[model samples]
Target: MYSSIYTESKEMYDELKEWRRELHKTPELGLELPQTVSFVKNKLTELGIPFETKVNGNCIVGYLGSGERCLLLRADMDGLPMFEESQLSYASQNGNMHACGHDIHTTALLGAAKLLKKHEQDLKGKIKLLFQPGEETFEGARAVIKEGILENPKVDAAFAVHVASTLPVKTIAYGTLTATSVFGFKITITGKGTHGAMPQNGIDPINVGVTIYQALQELIARECAPSKEVSLTIGQFNSGTMNNVIPETAVLQGTLRTFDSETKQYLITRIKEIVKNISKAFRAESKIEVLTDIPVLCCDEKRNEEIVKALNLMNAELKIISGLHTTGSDDFAVYANEVPASYFMIGAKENSNTIYAHHNPKVCFNEQVLPIAAAVYACTALDWK
Candidate 1:
């Protein structure tokens, strides 16, 4: 009943692609998406749809129809803080880029919005469109929820889509449970500076830093459970400015990911202990700070089944994947924690070896799947009873 809604509007697919391309050309970052927000608001107005803006900074919410079985569909609107490297005519300007395919996600939601508005009479319940910002920093979803976007209408089911490059085109894959907990840690060690010739005059911060890193490695490799997948990576390390002189302090920054809350907590505790012990052995003072903490994302099995059924009816390829959690994390888990939710991936890769991963300046997606994504999103909402 839903797939037929777009039969005569095939041209809208091209129009949507152009819109996506335009968004890609002028990318905005985090909660500061004025241009993007204005564009979405303008589109809703053009279609005669009603919407509310700035529930949370750049986030925009729109409502269609009136029913008790409320469904929430979300799309991220912010771009990365990196510069664009792709040579496409629609490449990002102003040094902001959609390295994570949020442009496509936003466009697909818009396409779905158009179709849903046209078929508003056939809908059984209310549908809330969440155009969220600051996803790159993992703050938008929580902000929007805190602003009462979910409480006012009280969503029964929520769905979100991410464009994936690993899966083939026209194929949709979703993990029943995805990694939800992610944390960033900053370890700073302070020691006494010394001249190169004096071995005992002062403590060397770099040496202490290295020892702490090795200790952390052992903690993860030997202490953590073998079955649990966890990552402890030190992405940045800085100390000393001169070759002959020791620096007083060294900094270590990295991220940690886990699927379980207990394991996540254990990891954090172990990291602190390791750093403390290492610093004591070197007679240095150390501090460990947690920058961010996100819970794990678990898809509602019932909602997932409904989504699969809808996709099947639309003649779309579907695959159920397990243990496919990436090191990356999303604040979308914040909403999933409170309500039944499903986050699906849309294939964006065109070639096996040529596609780049997310957060890279060169990352790009296959625009041809925009319509397919929009169709799936619309169909899922249509079937959500």
Candidate 2:
């Protein structure tokens, strides 16, 4: 039953690897991905697939088949700002890195597109391919929606696959709440600057920044329920420009993650209050801003069951991982929030080499999982009821 799926996917395995390598060599960042966009466009054109560029985004959407029911499959096309140290022959010479395996995501979707286009006549419904950018900045999916990528035919359901670093190849992992909702915030504290010799003359924004940080931690510890999960991290703190001179302003940036919506809102509300009160006590004026707030990605139970059944036909293991949720966030939440959506993780761990986590300079991915992911995406789109 699954012979044809694997055979077709295997045929594109070489092309998929080449695409992944080429993309790995030239990783682009944020909303503007000129080279990445061009590469994907050329491939779509070569496949004789009809597509539209910039559904008001720095991305492209390809369409195949015709029917009342439409399904959207998404692939994020952005790279992190970190430098690569993997030292592979195809390793990026440029500073940017595809440390999160987005290159694999893009290529797998392309592979599935090729497969689906060849069998388009057999398909009963329409398939919309969303090649999105700026996922790293958590703005791509929202931008795709803003540009109306889900309209015209109006998507009924959606699907996406993210690569997993630790799970072994060919393993499929998913859950009800796959990931936590996250909010990125920045707090700026302003105070009087003074020479180090005259400490009393300065309001000391650095001291205020540290106090706020500690207070934020306490909010997590004391206010949050012991059974619930929430994380608050201060990733960046910038203050003094010199040893003797106290900087007039201190900037604090961090992230908040929670699994429940009420907890998420409560944390955000408390965070603002904590920062405001702490700064006021230190006699410093402060402002807090939320850079981005991505909702928790919840898989549609019906859609997830359909995907799991479809994948099982290809002889894949569908693992319902419990209490293994990730703190990291994805803008795919934006799409899932709008439609019946399901996102799965494809295990790509190659045990021989040292495993480096995502966003690390030395991160590596198992290319062998490329065809598996392609097959799963194609089969899920094709076999869904």
Candidate 3:
């Protein structure tokens, strides 16, 4: 039965495709995933996979096998807070969309749960299924870790797969330094409220915010080395309401990402110093709030070799590409930092030139990669030493 993992996963294609489309329709966001959790719970129950809700109710943990060595297979179950423009019949009408292909991630893990459960007795070790919530906000994994989501069984290794819309279908890419660390922040600038016409009476916080934003951007180009992989992006800026009244405060939110820890620390210190000194020069009060701090997703090289070999042995026809890395961040970084772990990207793009990247409203993934991902998840676990 274990030898037929790839074939069986392919046989379940229609069922897995339905699961992905249904999940794509009713996407949830943040730590609160009510309907999404309910659907996962029901499916897990039907498959006779026992699981317990932990942390935020929907961040569930399902069990398989009972040996000393355990492998954690994680799937994030949250979506982005954006409207879908993809005119597919099952496109999400709700304000939220699974533009990141997390729907495919969750469904592939479920398909793995089904396959692993069918051959539980032949397994040499344990496989822990983590149906995590709040990945987009970077809160779910931290909360779960606090409550000991990794303690009860103490996993030896972990694995995760993300769907990529730009790569050809059925291609699997692996690498050592898979993703960059991220530090998300919000800066608040406070200025006195006054009539807009009386510009002399009030300090302009918007001006201070604009200056700080510019300084932050320049840090990457001027302060950092050209060879270092670093980036800064300010996504949101909110200030005044009325045209005649000067607002009391302005807020700017942004994220900084890099692969080097020393570089990350240097930038954070510079950011704080820049904000403090810039606000003082502008005669405005300011405060900086830390929103998220995640480490770089550094895949274990030896483990990567083992998993890559296991995957090829599982399906000889499967394409295994190497040396792919990105600056984008994932909270799976938290898990990889804790244990010997590896991550893979399975290609999910349709055969078309217009491939929209992740988080795009019009993004679509090839459903054919669903079973391939499921097979990879299950076979990787079953074949692990």
lDDT of each: 0.82, 0.87, 0.91
Give the best candidate by TM-score.
3
Instruction: Give the least accurate 10-residue stretch of model 1, judged by summed lDDT.
Output: 315-324
Model 2 C-alpha lDDT versus the unseen true structure: 0.87
User: Can you write out model 2's per-residue Cα lDDT over 224-275, one digit (the tens) per residue?
Assistant: 9877888889989999979999889999999998889998888888888888
Tens digits of per-residue lDDT, candidate 3, 119-156, equal 78777898899999988999987888898877889989
> Ten consecutive residues with minimal summed lDDT in candidate 3?
1-10
Query: Comparing candidate 2 with candidate 3, which one achieves the higher lDDT?
Result: 3
Lowest summed lDDT over 10 consecutive residues: which window, candidate 2? Answer: 315-324
Clashing pairs in 2: none
Clashes of each: 3, 0, 0
What TM-score against the true fold does each predicted structure earn?
A: 0.92, 0.96, 0.98
- Overall local distance difference test of candidate 1: 0.82
Which rank order by TM-score, best down to worst?
A: 3, 2, 1
Per residue, candidate 1 scores C-alpha lDDT tens digits across 345-365 of: 877776646878888888778
Best by lDDT: 3
